[model samples]
Structure formats: C-alpha cells, structure tokens
Target: MNLNLRHAIMQNISGNSQEELRETIVDAIQNGEEKMLPGLGVLFEVIWQNCSEQDRQEMVQVLESSVRK
Candidate 1:
C-alpha cells in the first residue's frame, strides 16, 4: 500500500509476461484489495500517456464500468 511497494510492483509488472500480470491483477481485484487500485492508476497513467484517442475512450469505458460495479 505504501508508495514504495506500489512502485516496486509497477516495476515488477514490466518483468511479468502478459498472462502473469493479468492473473496477478485479477487476483488482486477478486480479493478486494484497495491498495492495488493505486498501482492500477499508475498503469493507467502510463497507458494514457502514450495511448491514442480511441484508446483513451476505451480506457474511459473501462473506468466507467469499474465505477458502476
């Protein structure tokens, strides 16, 4: 939950294969751990920085879906 751990996890994410990261994220969510949200926010920021307009819209959709749950 601390910023250090969050940064560490974000760094670790780059090392994970896509499937591994996907599983880790899914598990984190299923357990209802709010700390993961911050790290996910970081990931979203990283993606948004370079994402195209269409991708940004998709990201907003994803955010909306999460908020509705």
Candidate 2:
C-alpha cells in the first residue's frame, strides 16, 4: 500500500478552525501514540514554513528547554 501521509493529513484537516486545530494537537499529545508523531511532524513542517525567524528561534529555545528539563 502506498500512502502520502503528509498530503493525506493536510487534506483531512485542510479547513479546520483554530479551536479545532488546537483540539487535534492536544488530543494527539495526550494520546501519546507513536502513530501520531508523523502527523505532528507534518503540522510542525507547516508551522516552520510559515513562521518568522524570531518565531523559529523561540520555538527552538522552547524545544531545547523542554528537552533539558
């Protein structure tokens, strides 16, 4: 079976509202399932593509801090 996971996930959530997106993220994280990681990575790719340099820097900082604790 061939599947383009990123494209499929994007298509599934294409027109979601902010609250719906938030809920999806929260649910994925709370579920803590390995299968959810790819979806989150695709979401992060979208965010990284759209964010400013400062925003990226802040995200890196937060990621670093989260890993350190």
Candidate 3:
C-alpha cells in the first residue's frame, strides 16, 4: 500500500479558513507530537512554494534566528 503523507495532509486541510489554519498550527505546536511534524512540513512547503524569493529569504532568516536561541 502506498501512503502519500504530503498529499493526504493537504487534502485534510484544503478549503480551511485562515483562522482554522492558524488554529491547526497552534494546536499542533501546543501538542508537540512528533507525528505532527510531517503535516507542519507540508504546510511550510506550500508556504515556501507560494511566496516570493524575498519572502523566502526572510523566512529562512527568521528560522535561523529562532533556532539560535
């Protein structure tokens, strides 16, 4: 059986409202379960794919700065 996690995650969240999306992220973070990491990565992939180059750079910088803490 083929388990396509990224596609499945996208399907689960498709058509969600902005607030609903925010809640999903917030809930996932608060829970801090390892199983939730793939879904979060897929969401971040979608964001990276849609954003401009400058936005991508900014996100990278933000990630770098946060991880240094």
Pairwise lDDT winner, candidates 1 and 3: 3
**Could you give candidate 2's per-residue lDDT for residues 1-69 as a string of tens digits?**
125988899998999999999999999999999999989999999999999999999999999999999
Candidate number that wins on TM-score, 1 or 3: 3
lDDT of 3 by residue, 17-53 (tens): 9999999999999999998988888899899999999
Candidate 2: C-alpha lDDT: 0.93
Model 3 misplaced stretches (Cα beyond 4 Å)? 1-3
Global lDDT of each candidate: 0.80, 0.93, 0.92
> Could you tell me the lDDT of residue 50 within candidate 3?
100
TM-score of each: 0.66, 0.93, 0.91
Q: Model 2: how far is 53 from its true place, Å? A: 0.3
Candidate 1 per-residue lDDT over residues 7-55, each given as its tens digit: 7867878778989977877887798888678777676677789989999
Best by TM-score: 2
Clashes of each: 0, 0, 0
Q: Regarding lDDT, does 1 or 2 come out ahead?
A: 2
The residue pairs found clashing in candidate 2 are none
